[model samples]
Target: MTDLHFECTGARPEPFGASPTLLFGLRIEESDHQPVHAIALRCQIRIEPVRRQYEPEEVGMLGDLFGEPSRWSSTLKPMQFAHSSITVPGFTGTTDIDLPVPCTYDTEVASASYFRALSRGEIPLLFLFSGTVFTGRNGFRAEPIPWHKESSYLMPVDVWQQMIEEYFPNSGWLRLRKDCLESLRRYRSQRALSSWEQVFQELLATAGAKGGD
Candidate 1:
């Protein structure tokens, strides 16, 4: 019967990951100073919408995810951000480890949309922890971590934006339906467009000229 305390000290962008990632500094302390062998940790991270205020522009950008500002009282709720698992090495009383969380820029996801909408400030995040904890003199005991173990952290929005910029670099991504993509490909091929940007610009110009007439 050991009680564990979790705290997130800070976060930073991972340098050499395949996808964009943020590594959070996690400190875990056990109530009883027993020799723990390891922890098979699983954490559910949530974005708490009501924990922070939003700018007018942010609210406008986030309307698609949470609806209008007027309706936020009902709509403002925790959003599932990510789920990550790690094997925390054993310690006597306390230990610090890196909690790596994979991130995406897919606007279709509510968490990603919410993150993109924010210009500045901290993101209120809740980490719910569960799994098996191994302990004892020779790693003899195994027990289940309590369900109520949770921790809150305010992650700087700038950190997330910076990480995204590092990977995307002044660009955005979108996933199109196969049929729509095929149609766009055909359009591009018909005009011998060199790039998708050009194809889109040509379409916009054609639409504008038609509207002018």
Candidate 2:
């Protein structure tokens, strides 16, 4: 059996990807210095929210997801970020690979909301690894990678911000129900609103007036 170790060296935004993507640099090593036929690797990435501190503004933004700060001890749990897989070609002793993690700007997602709330500092991440390892000295052999295999990484917040900015510059995404969308469209048409932003601005002004009264 090959004793394998995994490490996340760093991460960066994928410039040419069709969608928003993050490439994590992964390093894998074999203890016995044997020839590996290939590895079918599956990774589950999680965000450990409890591992980092939050700002006052961030807390306000996170209220919908985790509730109030007073109740955070129970609410602030690990959130699933992504599940990704890669097939590493045969290598001797050690090798490096990029794990492409597809990302979304949809703020309705818990992970995306949490990420957007952060102002600064690293996001604590836990990577759980599993899959099959094909290796042998003489011929092809297969072994199950242990379930206990895991790694931790502190991904810089700026990296995520940069990626989002590159794709959505000065904009954010929101998901609404079909009925609500149709209503907004009707409202916009009735008012002859040239853009969605204008429609939202008018609605907010109306809401503010109603609140004041």
Candidate 3:
């Protein structure tokens, strides 16, 4: 059996990734100073929303996900952010690896919406780790990594913002049904709307006028 420890030192935005991605610094340590042949590490990252305080504006934005602020006591629960895996090469004592976590800008996703709602402060994250550990002095022996292997890290909100900005500058993603998209397209064609922004603006103005009536 091997005793393994995990820690998330920091995180940063992946500049050259094809999509919005975050790289979390993962440090793994072997307690007994044993030579680890290899490791197939799988991690489940979760956002612990109850661990941090929310601003008034943030609370308002998060209403759709967590409901009213007063109901947050019960509604605020951990949300899954990403599930990622990495192959760790053999090491004797310890090793550091980059955990690549692919992210999406779709506002329909709970994690993305929660992240967008945040203005500042760190996001409390819980990393649950599991996988196979290959180790032995004479030869390689396969063993299961304990389920209790977990770590907690406070990721700065700015990092996420930076990643989003890099991938989508001054823009946001909204997923709509096929029928709704067709309807929007027809509306845009009929009105000769040059851009989606203009279409949305026109619709909002019309809605406001109707509301005042």
Candidate 4:
């Protein structure tokens, strides 16, 4: 068995409230063991309040708008985990992890369209994966538990973009923005142009025939 180190970068933050957050980019390293397939390192979040009290106007407005379920306050809410995981293969060890959570406004919409309407940028949720060392057969295993801290605010996507640009200016951060747009465009194009599954099946058939030679 080969020893491999694994790291995950770009784990997004979960919405606790309007507080600023520090999102971490992961770096994993290991020796003497093969990396496990689909191992994820969960992130740790910590929140400290700068102000002591919630804004009266904000609270009032929430009560007026939500009618009763508005428990909006100054503290960050608990972090919510997504049903997703990161996959890696072969490993000696792994460390520092960041994984983005997919956003589906369906639940939010069903509960409160007002809350969903207030959304901007990407949602501040994270994907938590089981962290482990020891990949294939004949390898040693280390099971890791995920730890999460909650706050009372959501970090806007715009804030995250600005932070990225500031911290990693020379890293071609705009490329990531462009990539997100490009991916969305590609997905929309495929949906509009034809059946994606049919297209994929055709390509598979062509490849299989060629390989038969």
Candidate 5:
């Protein structure tokens, strides 16, 4: 595994399924490296229906695209793990990278609800989009978690844009924030998102954690 930097503001630990073993799901990467490939981001939000508990997803994107989503079964459980591609232009291959997540604390209720459950040990966290598991080339193609969205598994551009602003917003942060924002803006509808640029600036001022650069 590549050595990654992560941090947790309001995170702890919990248990997984079946075996119900304790698992930790907090932002673990704190680095200044730019993601090599994809312009998109993904996060693994831990949820527990039993106690109505959940955990905040990590907030950032890692390296570039390599291949397609390869589905495989967990050696211990029926739960499926989807391993995506991995490819960075000159970076050989990153053995370690964290998933990208947004500051849900200041945004929608889904995020709030998840955080609330996190403190209760009702769920365990995972980095679904980190280079540790999934990957992409040029840009990562996101599949919507059926549990997160009903229509398309791909994260709608607006949500992705907000996430970008939250984690890596500086011009030096990534060479493609402008492109990502522009793409999301193209998909913005009257009811979707109206102000990504403004949101980016606002989140930078508010979600003051010093990682995911």
Candidate 6:
């Protein structure tokens, strides 16, 4: 059995991708001098919300996901961030690979909302690794990568924000029902509203007026 060590060095925003993505740097080092042919690795990344403190505003933003902060004991659980896989080419003692973690801006996704709730500080992350490892210099032998092999990294919040900004600058993402969007579009046409923002403002104004009445 080959015992490989896993280390999460850090992460940064990917320069170019079809969508928002983060490139995590991982180092795989072998204890013995035995050469590693290749590694077919699958990584499951999770956000450890319970591992970090939340600000007042952040608490409010996360209320929809976790409910009241008082109930966080049961609510603040590890959320799935991304599931990614990569093939590490053959290497000797140590090898580094960039794990691409794609992201979405859809607020309906708890992961996206969880990320948006964070403004500053580091995000505690847990990376669970599993897969098959091929070893030997002359010939390759297959072995299962240890299931317990894992690593943790505190990723800076700015890295996420920067990636989002690159793809969704000065914008926020939301999902609306087809009928609801049609209704808003009809309202916009009727009132000659220029944008969806105007329609939302009008609705808020009307709701406030009714509340005061």
In order of listing, the candidates' clash counts read 0, 0, 0, 28, 25, 0
Backbone collision tally, model 1? 0
Give one digit per residue, the lDDT tens place, for model 2 in 101-132.
99998988999988999999999999999999
TM-score of each: 0.93, 0.97, 0.98, 0.33, 0.23, 0.95
Tens-place lDDT per residue, model 4, 39-152, is: 544443322222223344434434433344333443334333333345444434555554343333233322122222332443343323344433455555665533322223
lDDT per residue (tens digit) for residues 1-213 in model 1:
988999999999998999999999999999889888999999999999899988888888988987878899999989999999999998989999999999999988889989999999999999999999999875489999999999999999999999998999999888889999999999999999999999999999999999999
Worst 10 residues of 4 by lDDT: 110-119
Taken over the whole model, the C-alpha lDDT of each candidate is: 0.93, 0.95, 0.95, 0.42, 0.31, 0.91
RMSD of each: 1.9, 0.9, 0.8, 18.3, 20.0, 1.3
Error of 4 at 162 (Å): 13
The C-alpha stretches of model 4 lying farther than 4 A from their native spots are 1-25, 29-76, 79-81, 91-100, 107-131, 135-139, 142-155, 159-213
Considering lDDT, which of the candidate structures 3 and 5 is the better prediction for this target? 3
lDDT comparing candidate 1 with the true structure: 0.93
lDDT of 3 by residue, 1-213 (tens): 899999999999999999999999999999999999999999999999999998888888999999878898999999999999999999999999999999999998999999999999999999999999999998879999999999999999999999999999998868999999999999999999999999999999999999999
lDDT tens readout by residue for model 6, 1-213: 788999999999888899889999999998786898889999999999999988888898999899987899999889899999999998889998999998899988989989898989999999999999999767879999888999999999999999999888988867999998888888999999998888888999999999999
The candidates, ranked best first by lDDT, are: 3, 2, 1, 6, 4, 5
lDDT per residue for candidate 5 within 1-213, as digits (tens), equals 122333332321121222111122233331334343322233444322222222332111100110111311211111222222323132323323322232333322343332322232322222344433222345544332222211112122233333334443552222346888676556454336556665556557556655444
Q: How well does candidate 1 match the true structure in TM-score terms?
A: 0.93
The segments of candidate 2 whose C-alpha lies over 4 angstroms from its true place after superposition are none
lDDT of 4: 0.42
